[model samples]
Target: MVKSVPAWLRILSVVFVALTALILLAPLIVVVGVSVSESQFIAFPPNGLSLRWYSQVLSSNAYLGAGWISIQIALMVTGFATLIGGAAAIAIHRRQLPFSDVLATVFLSPLVLPTIIYAIGMLMFWSSAFGPVSPVTLALSHTIIALPYVVRTTLAVLAESNPYLEEAARTMGANRLQRLWFVVVPQCIPGLAAGAFFAFNISFDEAVLSLFLRGPTLTTLPVQIYGQLEFSPDPSVAAVSTIMIALTIVLIFVIDRMLGLTKFASA
Candidate 1:
């Protein structure tokens, strides 16, 4: 039988957990509070509760334009990263190719490198080859960074999967494509879904790469917020941040409803 914890220890654990959650959530709470402030200037605990900033954000052309650009790029990056990374994960997991370990490391190397470093390198390369920064360039950069998360998540799910399932399918006269479509793909759905979520979130929220590549016509939502923060500090920035936080929470809720989050968490 497992030993029970002392009452004091349990109470201490509860306090520690509560404190940790507060620390983690404090910034989000502040941003949400600032977004609803009646005062023109940003402040914590809010001068008077109002949603004028959110209304201002909705009316602003710059914010709407930037948000549209972000959505487009994020969708493109999510599609590319999910398809390429899922395929890469499957290949690596099967160990069908030579130097599989090296390949896996190379795929994950982007996660190890600093975002700034990648941003600089991408800027130079894209400028020389394409002659200008565009939405496609930004989407490609986002895909590179987002790829590792997809690969990692897919690999995690594959790790816990039965090694003989594919073989078993083949033994029953299923062809290569049939086994992959009917057997392998089903097992990878959870991981691919989780990875797609991460890819979308990362690409949508990524500021460093967007900053490096942003032109007047190509500014994304994060870069727009940064520009406002640098020049005209206002509660509108906080309002946008609060909106992003809410969207993220909604996305998480949707994902949880579709596939139990515990499966991804366990993986």
Candidate 2:
């Protein structure tokens, strides 16, 4: 039998959860409030209510271009990262290749390494090999950084699955391709979906790599926000940020519906 918590301890736990939630959500609330403010400057309490800042954001050519670029890069990153990372995870889990442990570590090294270091190295390497930074460069860099998350999530789910399924399929006359397609791929779906969401979110919000690879021609949404904050920031910036936050929330909801958030947590 399990012992129940004391009332005082339960009350303290509730208070702690409430405090944590408030701390995490306060900035988001302020951003949404400022986005709707009529004030020329960003303010927490907001000075009156208006949607003109959002209208200005929608009307700005620079913002529109940056948003489109961000969307494209994020989609590309999600596709490449999910494919490459998921495949690598399966290979590593099967231990089919030499130095599987080392390969896994190498694949995940980007997660432990400082992103700024990778950004600088990427910038120099690209400048020497290619000529200037472009959308392709941004997409490739984002894929590299996002790959680790996909690999990790996929590995986690694979670890918890029945290890004998692949062998059982083989004994039942299923070829390699058939086993992978019908058995392994189905097991990896939840992890892949979670990782794809993570990849999309990271690419959409990435700044360091985008900043280092930035050119006169290339600008992503986060880079645009940074430029605005550096030069002239106003309520319009808050409006754009609010919209991005909303997009993130929607993605979270979709991920939850697709696989259930608890699946990820348990994985």
Query: Which sections of candidate 2 miss by over 4 Å?
Result: 1-13
Reference-based TM-score of each model: 0.92, 0.92
Candidate 1: how large is its RMSD?
A: 2.1
Model 2 shows how many backbone clashes?
A: 0
lDDT of 2 by residue, 1-267 (tens): 888998999999999999999999999999899999998888879999999999999999999999999999999999999999999999998887999999999999999999999999999999999989899999999999999999999998898899899889999999989999999999999889889999999999999999999988799999999999999999999999999999999998998898788766666
Worst 10 residues of 2 by lDDT: 258-267
Taking the tens digit of each residue's C-alpha lDDT, what string does model 1 give over 77-96?
99999999999999999998
> Each model's C-alpha lDDT?
0.93, 0.94
Per-candidate clash tally: 0, 0
Clashing pairs in 1: none
Q: Alpha carbon lDDT of residue 214, candidate 2?
A: 90
